[model samples]
Target chain A: MKILVCVSKTPDTTSKVAFTDGNTKFDEAGVQWIINPYDEWYSLVRAIELKEKDASVVIHMVTVGGADTEPIIRKALALGGDEAIRVNSDSTDSYYIAAQIAEIAKQGGYDLIFTGKETLDYNGSSIGGMVAELTDAPYISLATKFDLEGTTATVTREIEGGEEVAEVALPAVVSCQKGMAEQRIPNMRGIMAARTKPLKVTEPVAADALTAIVNFELPPAKAGVKLVDAENVEELVRLLHEEAKAI
Target chain B: MSVLVFIDHADGHVKKSSLEALTYGAKVAAQLGTSAEGLLLGTVTEDLAALGKYGVTKIHQAANEALNNLDTQVYAAAIAEAVTASGATVIIFSHTPTGKAVAARVSAKLKAGLVTGACALPDTSNGFVVKKGVFSGKAFANVSINTAVKIISLNPNSYMTVAGEGTAAVAPLAISAGAAKVKVTAVNKVSGDVPLTEADIVVSGGRGLKGPENWGILLDLAKVLGAATACSRPVGDAHWRPHHEHVGQTGVQVAPNLYIAVGISGAIQHLAGVNRSKIIVVINKDPEAPFFKAADYGIVGDAFEVLPKLTEAIKKMKASA
Candidate 1:
């Protein structure tokens, strides 16, 4: 089985979200970027697990970013991918990125493609489904468990109320969330092997996105906490009615 | 000119998010100097004409069983055909799983510019710019779309749902339908009173609830308040609850009117899913918990002790009312 995973570099979840240029763009000036958490935990880990079972399983890592994201791509390779491909252009929007990935996967003849359900930064879970549509592949979002036998892949997706198990065929795309696998850390040997692996950079095919970012801003600050006296139960009830209106 | 809104339904009832999307679409339609019409893909039990209260003037219902389950290709094709038939220049959808998929496919089909997860109305002074949540609800980004036909998927709970006296007229849509490539074998639904994603009130617990054995306090509170129950990532990871009830950066993202966190430390990952709640209440024995700072109300007490009293008080109030 050939599995392709799309990883994106986003700011670590703890970073203070701020914008520069009069709040026109995200201030990437002094922030650390890590692999999108969902992509790392679900998409990448499951791909590695499949590679272990089928030695013929080739795990291909792809990213849409400039040269700065190479280190993250290399780290993914160290985590256990056979090869890496970097689209040598900064993706301006989710559609452009999805187009680039779909184009590549179409040319490569991938049996399965996986992506994190949503990016932590953009919060756009559109890439996987968009790619699936672009390539005319079946898509299953938020998969927790994925298994393959013959050409059928049984996937379990965590929904709002419960789990949904699906049976899909080959040449499918999946957007993965948690409960996919036990987290894995790169070992010394895997890290050393990654150094010797080939990292290819290819020019992006010409495709213009129809949308563009107008500006970026942070949400309003949360109000200071209000502590009501525990003894004043009536006050709490009244506040729940008048102030919070949560009752 | 007219705006088209996709109406999402599940198990015969229309979803709350779709109503909000309808309201959003209607508001956008007004802003664009156009009328708004709705397109229903699947079967629904609710009165279609009553939906006019949300500002839509007409409804195009395609009562096909093939649409009971979501198939983006079929939905996109159907919506595009409806748009063409209705002479719609703008399209709207909710930022749910089905909406995201169908909107993109429709955008490609119509060559329209799309803005997903829009939180506010567009600024049409110069061009069409829509504001949306970025950085997992930590920040906002304004995207400008310059296209002949535009597409937008509104975020849940961002726009207030408004109703008017106008009731829409229903019109049955007659279009050639195709068989869906995928089929739903069985639906292994998670058993709960309220769907977690669309719940108005949510009560979530974390590791501080101690263990799965002591989750009664959380459930008791949720039951009394008629709220959906959720857990932090650690609790779900521990198998105390199913992974589907997990709400965090890597889990389900919800925007309830009220989110009450019990024994939760409020990690950034967890907050990403729920920061959109209008009001937040954090109850914990430790006063130094991180959630208190973001909470509108904070209570420093043990969950075992506080939760029971809270549930009792709410039940008494409901009975009195």
Candidate 2:
């Protein structure tokens, strides 16, 4: 089974988020990048577990970004991906990125595709569905559990207030989240093996970015907290009702 | 050129988020000098005409049972057909799970620009620019859509639902919902009065609560406030609470009106999920807890000592009101 796992680089969760260039671009000056947690901790790890069960499974990691994204992709390779494909583009538009991945999926003819539920930077949960639509495959989002049997895949996904179990034929797209797999760290052996893994870079296919970033603005800073004494519980309630109007 | 809003429903009732979407769509239509209409794919028990009070002028119904269970591909196809037939230049969704599942698919099929988790109406004064939360609500981005056909999925609770006096004309839409590729086998619903995503107020607990045995106080507080109960990652990880109750960057992200955290330290991951909330109150025994930095109200006191009193006070306040 050939599985294509789409990965993206995002600022580390602890990094202070800021914008640059008249707020049209995210400031990368002091930002530390990591493989998006959902992609690394869930989607890619689950594929590795599936590979552990079947020796025939080959996991290929694909990322859409510039060269700065290589280290993150290489880390994913150390985690267990057999090969890596980088679409040389830095477009942040969801459609542009999905179109790039869809092109790679079409050429690879993989049986399964995996992506994180959404990227940490943009929080746009649109790529998996767009790729599924572009490739004419069934797409499942917010998958918490996934199991494969022969050519059929069973997925447990989160809905509004509950979970739903669904089954789809092979060659489907699954956007994974927590509960799908546990986080795994790359060992020295895996890290060394990743150094020898084939890293392929391809130019991005011609695709129009449907949307453009106009500007970014940070959320207003919080007014200093109102410290309520432990004895004055009623005052807190009064403040919530009268001052904050939250209750 | 018209605006078509997708009315998401379950068990024959329209969702609260969809109402917000309807109002948002109506306002966008008004901005563009066109009428706003609604499309309901499944059978609903609610009066379709009454939804016009949310500002829709017409309601299109596709009363199909298959459409009720959220098949993304089928729903996208049905919505695409509705868009084409209605000559809608813009589409609106609620940014709920159902909307997240299908909005991008329709955008892909129709080659329209799509923006999810939009926090405001489009700034049509210049071009079709939509403002949305980026970096998990740490910041906002104004995105411009260049496509002629545009889709916006409004984040729940972001827009107020304005109701006026009017009734919509319900029309039966003719379209095939197509075969569902993914077959749902079972649905396990979490029984709760308020789903965390739609709850106006949320009361959450953390590791400082000691264990699951002490959850009663938190539940009592939630019950009094009519709020949903959630948990920090550590609590969910320890299975003291179900994983569904976990709210963080990796878990469920909620933007409730009021979020009260008991014992949580307000880690960045946890804050990412809930920083969008209108108001935040942090209760922690440790005065140095990081959650106090982000909180609008903070009480440095033991949960065991503070919770019962706060719950009783809120309960009394509610009873008297």
The model with the greatest lDDT is 2
Report the error of model 2 at residue B155, Å. 0.8
Which candidate gets the maximum DockQ versus the true structure? 2
Q: Calculate the i-RMS of every candidate, to one decimal place.
A: 1.8, 0.8
* Fnat for each model: 0.55, 0.83
Model 1 lDDT per residue over B1-321, tens place: 799899988778888889998998898889988899999997988899999999999999988877877766677778878988999988999887677657876776676888888988888788889898888888889998878888899887788789887889888887675766555566777665688877889999999999999988899989988899999999998999877788888778888888999999998889988998888988888888988888888788888877887787777777887
TM-score of each: 0.96, 0.99
Chain B TM-scores per candidate, in order, are 0.96, 0.98
Local accuracy by lDDT, each model: 0.84, 0.94
Tens-place lDDT digits, model 2, residues A40-139? 9999999999999998999999999999999998898999979999999989999999999999999999999999999999999999999999999999
RMSD of every prediction: 1.7, 0.9
| Interface RMSD for candidate 1 relative to the native interface | 1.8
lDDT of 1 by residue, A165-193 (tens): 77877888888877787777889998899
